[model samples]
Target: MLNSNLLRKLDMQDLMVFIAVYQQSSVTGVSEALFVSQSTVSYCLKKLRTSFEDDLFINTRTGMRPTHKACTMYAHVLKILESINLCHAGPATFDPTRQAVTFNICAPEYFEHLILPRLLKNFDFADLPVIVNMHKLETDIPADELRDGSLDLVICFGPNFHRSHPDFKSQVLVEDDLVCVFDKRATPLEPRFSLQAFVERRHVFPTPWTSTTNMVDGWLARQAYKRQIVARANSYSAALKMITGTDFILTLPRRIQKLLAKDTIFNHCEAPNGLPGFTLNMQWSQNSDPDSANTWLRDQVLKACAEQGLS
Candidate 1:
């Protein structure tokens, strides 16, 4: 039971008014930013209130305060407004030789280390303005940033994260099996590792921030097995450094092992339990600017994965 006519009446201008007011928390601030009279901004607010059938903002001693309803509505409204802007702006004349853009990615540093070097070598972003910001991937609320437009894309371990968000699209870029890495010189036994042998050895595991553990831990729980984690670290790099020249073994992605093959200190060890391989996905929100630039960026990521023999 939705009123199509009522929804159609709501436009981008009204959304802009709402966003400006929400950010600045005052009609005067919005007026200053939009270069309009205070009355004009107030008028737009009134229209939005009527459209939403709620008092979206309240006059306070300090400035203006948003109602709980307004706070919740702002996120969706902002996303919709951004999508509309992208659609109208159309594709940019993306000249990598001179164009400038900032791309934000949410992923682990290990992922960046494996893919960024070769990826950057192919693109000439010297004259063109470019900025790449890497964000740590969170286990909880995977696609929240992408939906809110804070993140352009997410490189996550699996498809489970995007199943609920139908507006997002994903492509599997690489499949990686889990492998144990140990120093070749420190390894005492044969090349093959048994489940008993794995459990008997001291292991290095990336510690979860809270009670919630990682996928490997979950897999271990299913088998009714747990490792005696002698060393814990927040990142794979830290874990790798900790295990080098030590007797501790670390579970790592095969792609990472392949990338680090040149390093004489590390060698792959067999996992007898046959841990499940994970798929690395390249995901973007449907709300993203469907411009040529966005398309080119996605293509570049895919090409880089293929070049690294990860595809």
Candidate 2:
């Protein structure tokens, strides 16, 4: 027989708040962690104290110190919360090929221009009832949105521009060398290009990040040579347009040049020998690592990269 008094007093949200308070050890921390108001956490704590017939947490100089009762409840509350998550996740029954899913991805123009077309061309996702919503990449790691289920995946240039967290998983998906693009009619260069031409010429930088500096510039700085950046465009396509029929040079990834090979208007040359290549990495929340749908999507991306010889 179950006790109706305890059952009536129990609330899932209160238990969640209790668990959060235990973990955070501060009312403000709990509020932010759970995305709730401090007053709401206080209300939940009051209910927890009444239901348990004890002040679960004691205010201390350092933080909210857990009482003996709270210490005992911690493991049990954790299990309950995890069980609730598993119930909602339903990974055991997930079938990616037939499941209805909407994936929200955060990516930069780099992914859009280079990888997405190949992925779409090689895979049939629309028929599978899969919709991919792309959001502009904001940071090296957008953990807050990913943690709250606002974003399913993130793709960005790395390993220079990467921040790792224990709750997220990342993998390098593709790599490519650098090449310098110029309009041959406007800024003709011999097959034997010299580093002097690279520095003497004005350059157009294409990058989504606010900073115009990159690995290329870092190498140049090491050698005490800095290329003059005449213009900074928000994307590579824009930079290409800005430099075409002009003397401005745009140095970008070789894969980008491969994609634009048909455009006779722009010609690419081997980058200064020592300039390093770049890598693109894909990241996802750890919670999604075991999800069948996520697994399928990641596999599809890898397949596209392998087929396109871009891996």
Best by TM-score: 2
Looking at model 1, report the run of 10 residues with the lowest lDDT sum: 206-215
Q: What is the lDDT of residue 260 in candidate 1?
A: 58
RMSD of 2: 15.0
- Candidate 1: misplaced stretches above 4 Å? 1-93, 125-127, 159-164, 207-211, 261-263
Mind giving the per-residue lDDT tens digits that candidate 2 earns over 186-236?
645476347787898899988765444577788899988999999988888
Off by over 4 Å in 2: 1-93, 122-126, 209-212, 261-263
Give per-residue lDDT, candidate 2, residue 53. Answer: 84
Spell out the clash pairs found in candidate 1. none
TM-scores, each model vs. reference? 0.64, 0.66
Each model's lDDT: 0.75, 0.80
